[model samples]
Target chain A: MSRTRVHNFTISLDGFATGEGLSAEQPFGHAGHRLHQWMMATAFGAPIMGLPGGSSGVDNAFAQQHEPGIGAEIMGSRKFGPPGWQDDPNWRGWWGPNPPFHTPTYVLTSRPRSPLEMEGGTTFHFLDAPGAEALKIAQEAASGKDVRIGGGPTMLRDFLAAGLIDHLHVVQVPVLLGRGVRLWDGLEGLEQQYQVETVSTPSGVTHFTFSR
Target chain B: MSRTRVHNFTISLDGFATGEGLSAEQPFGHAGHRLHQWMMATAFGAPIMGLPGGSSGVDNAFAQQHEPGIGAEIMGSRKFGPPGWQDDPNWRGWWGPNPPFHTPTYVLTSRPRSPLEMEGGTTFHFLDAPGAEALKIAQEAASGKDVRIGGGPTMLRDFLAAGLIDHLHVVQVPVLLGRGVRLWDGLEGLEQQYQVETVSTPSGVTHFTFSR
Candidate 1:
């Protein structure tokens, strides 16, 4: 049974997955790395800082969960690229040549593009499927492992509202974005379906995991 | 210098301070005691259950902060009573003859009413002042001790946005209210102003404290 999961998805106190006006220059917009700075200080996120070792505490333990047994990832177009990456034919994702997602990554976009094969067993497949349809494709591509729902809040909220996520892990950063897309908007009473657990690390980030 | 603070304010994982359509019958609306159940299990909150001994853990320690430094309490009308409470002249408050608040309590409402003197020194004074002006009156009522800014999300958010709160303690309950009044709205960049702390207890509630 292929499961769908969301891991290490950092959100502000106000529930913004990423700050407003995301772009190539600032993928996180006004938020910058505030939502992810805590993770960047973790062992799994040390790569972002060009460091060898990061904290191995509970924060790192949760951050490291991003990779194990994940065969494919489905992400929204907003996450695949900035506002208008489709306009630039030469645009090759924010992550350089060797991206972090070393799996068959399906990018959900209104305008689908041709598959872009990169190093490290990662191939970008653009799809225009809705939540359930997209999950079906990603589940098939996962091939019995698991499919990760990489997000912008809107996409994550869509999947969550559609009841497609089997496991959801949200890291609540202390910062309040005030504005931006909200992940919990349509997810009212969504906690009833899943068994939720919460842990607070010394860094002040609370890790929330929901398993159905 | 009397500082204003917020303590033992419990909110859901989705940031709803209280569930929607709050009324006299359903005080916390659809949320009921779900958000504050963890506190109800604590030593300080045990009295609300007509009990003596309760868990003497971190939650009790945090809940105990509600009384020590406070003299008078200032709260929005929403916290004072249900909607359209002004129409009912017979309505003293939601609490019984001897309310939980044993000090001079100021209720912010557009329609100011004559003070209601209840048992146990709890006096409900309806004021039409805005956040700052209302705080000034509450501070004077405190005489020297700190004034507690009791909340219903809208009132607390106003005080928070106005930068009038010296300390903010929010208890994050594991439950999720799909729709309701949010506590963190318009509070962007609030973390930078405070030295924030987090602690998760066995009761599965995480307490977030922001001290300036």
Candidate 2:
């Protein structure tokens, strides 16, 4: 069965997945790279940033799960770029010409654009649909493999609230963003539904995996 | 040299220390005892609630730190009692005659009342002083022992914001309280000052200790 999974979703201690005032220049706003520093230090994340080597410990073990079985990805439009990305005609994505996603990635947006094929097997498909609708499209595109719920907090919270996620992995970094888009907002009684497992790494980031 | 410390301060994944609709009847409000359930299962916490033979694991290791070095306690008015506790002359505290805090516990409230001495060494002293002044009084009462900053989120945040705390131990409970009093508000860049250490126990709670 093709499951909907969310991996490597990082959030601050105060539950802010991404910081406020996100722009084209500052993608994560004032948060900078603080939230993702742990992942960056991992072997899986280093090469993505063009680094030579990284740690192969607990953080690397979880960070490497981002690719393996993921066939299609459904990301919020905000994850593709900053706010007002739809207004910009030339806004491809933050990942440049050859994006990290080698799957048929679907971007959820009000303004759906034509299919844009990048290098490797990655293809950007825009859709103006809700959580369930977007998941269905992504699942269909995923074929026999699983669909990855790529997020920027708003869409992740929506999918989580709707109980569409089968496997959810969130990295909780020890930092307070103070004000930002909270990932755990309206996610009351979430632990009741899933079998939650938490493990803290030496790098000072706790990984939470909620499996149904 | 008496250091100010905060221990066993539990909060939800969303950063809520206590749930909304807190009253005299429901001290922790809609949150019930969910936030402190992990602590309750600990050896130190179980005996406090009249329970016997609890787990002496990682949770207990952290839970037991509440009283060892502390001499005096400083808690917010909300922590001492509910919202309308000041109006009620008969209101002592939620901890009953033999309160757990066996020290001179200072309650920061606008309407300061006469000292209420309980059966235990816990004497509730109402004060209108700010975080710094309250710390000063608590430190004097603590003598050479360390002073503990007891919380109800607001006061803890104030003490944390004022940089009056030397050690802070926060247990991140897995559950998410949709709406409540947040503890991490206005605490941005907190990690820069303190040497943070994260450890996730098998009880599904992440223990975060920040020491300067």
Candidate 3:
């Protein structure tokens, strides 16, 4: 079964996945990297920071679940780049030559561009489609493997609201981001659809996994 | 020293403390009793429902912490009664004759009325005061004991935003209310002052305690 999963999508206590004033220089805006500090301290996330070692605690255990059966990723346009990435002709991505998503990564945007293949099997395929439509394209590209909903909040909220997510993992950080793009907006009765499990690590971040 | 604290205050995943269309019949509005269901199942909360026994687990431990060190309570007008409660002269609060407060409970409202003394120690004092002024009055009434900030979300947000709270215990309910009175508005960078601790119980609700 081709499942659609969202792993390690971090949000503030107020449910803001990213923060206000997000720009090219400040990816997460006022939030900075506060939302992802827990992940950075984890063993799975440490390698991304070029660190030799990190905590192998519960955080690392959850962080390592990001790339298991994930063959294709569908991310929001904001997640692909900053505000005006479409205007810039040379905007490949934030991840330099070789991006982290080692799959056929689909970027949902109104203004579509040609597929830019990166190193390590990662390719940026810009698609001018809705969430469901984008998911279908990603699913086909995923082949036998599952599709990953790479988020920036708005995209994930739309997918969850539309009942397209199969497995969703959310990390709740303690900080309160006053204003930002919220993840739980319009998701009123979302719990009724999934079996939710939660665990709080020593680092003070609570991990919530909603599985259908 | 009288410390101001908020305890067992539950909010939905999207930061809604209470749902939309709140009325006298539905005290917590569309939220119903979903937010406090975890507390209701605890030994401390079970007694309120006339239950002989309940779970004495981590939820119970946190629920029991509500009363011990409190002498006075200050709640928002919305928490005391329904929206048009001030108009009705016969309104003596929803918590009947012998209310659970058992202390001088201050209700912040623009339309002040005479104090209604109940059967028990609980007395409803209507005051037209802001968060700080109300806290001062509550502190005096509390004497040496700690003063509890009884919330309905909007009131708590005000106290929190004003930086008048010394301790705050927020229960993150799994359900998302979607539309309602939010608790985390204007509370950015709140983690800086408080030492936060998170524990997710088997009841599927996460307890977050922020203490200075």
RMSD list, candidates in order: 1.4, 1.2, 1.2
Two-way lDDT contest, 1 vs 3, winner: 3
- Give the per-residue lDDT digits (tens) of candidate 3, residues B58-102: 999999998998999999999999999999999999877888899
Top model number, DockQ = 3
Model 3 residue B144 lDDT score: 88
Question: Residue B31's C-alpha lDDT in candidate 3?
Answer: 90
Kindly list the per-residue Cα lDDT of model 1 for residues B26-125, writing each as its tens digit.
Answer: 8889998898888878889888778788899788889999998789999888887889889999998888899988999999999998999999989999
- Give model 2's docking category: high
Q: What i-RMS does every model get? A: 0.9, 0.9, 0.8
Each model's lDDT comes to 0.89, 0.91, 0.91
Query: For each candidate, what TM-score against the reference?
Result: 0.97, 0.97, 0.97
lDDT score of residue A130 within candidate 2: 93
Candidate 2 lDDT score relative to the true structure: 0.91
lDDT of 2 by residue, B1-212 (tens): 89998999999888889998998778989999999999889899998888988998889988889989899999999998888888999999888789999999999999999999898799999999999998899889988999999898998998889999999999988887888899998999898899999999988899999999
Q: Model 2, residue A29: what's the lDDT?
A: 92
> Which portions of model 2 show Cα errors greater than 4 Å?
none
Candidate 1 residue-wise lDDT, A45-146, digit = tens: 999567787899988988888999999999999998899899999887988898899999999999998999999888999998888998888888888999
Candidate 1 displacement at residue B23 in angstroms: 1.4
Q: 1 or 2: which has the higher TM-score?
A: 2
Displacement of residue A167 (Cα, Å) in model 3 is: 0.6
- Alpha carbon lDDT at A133, candidate 2: 91
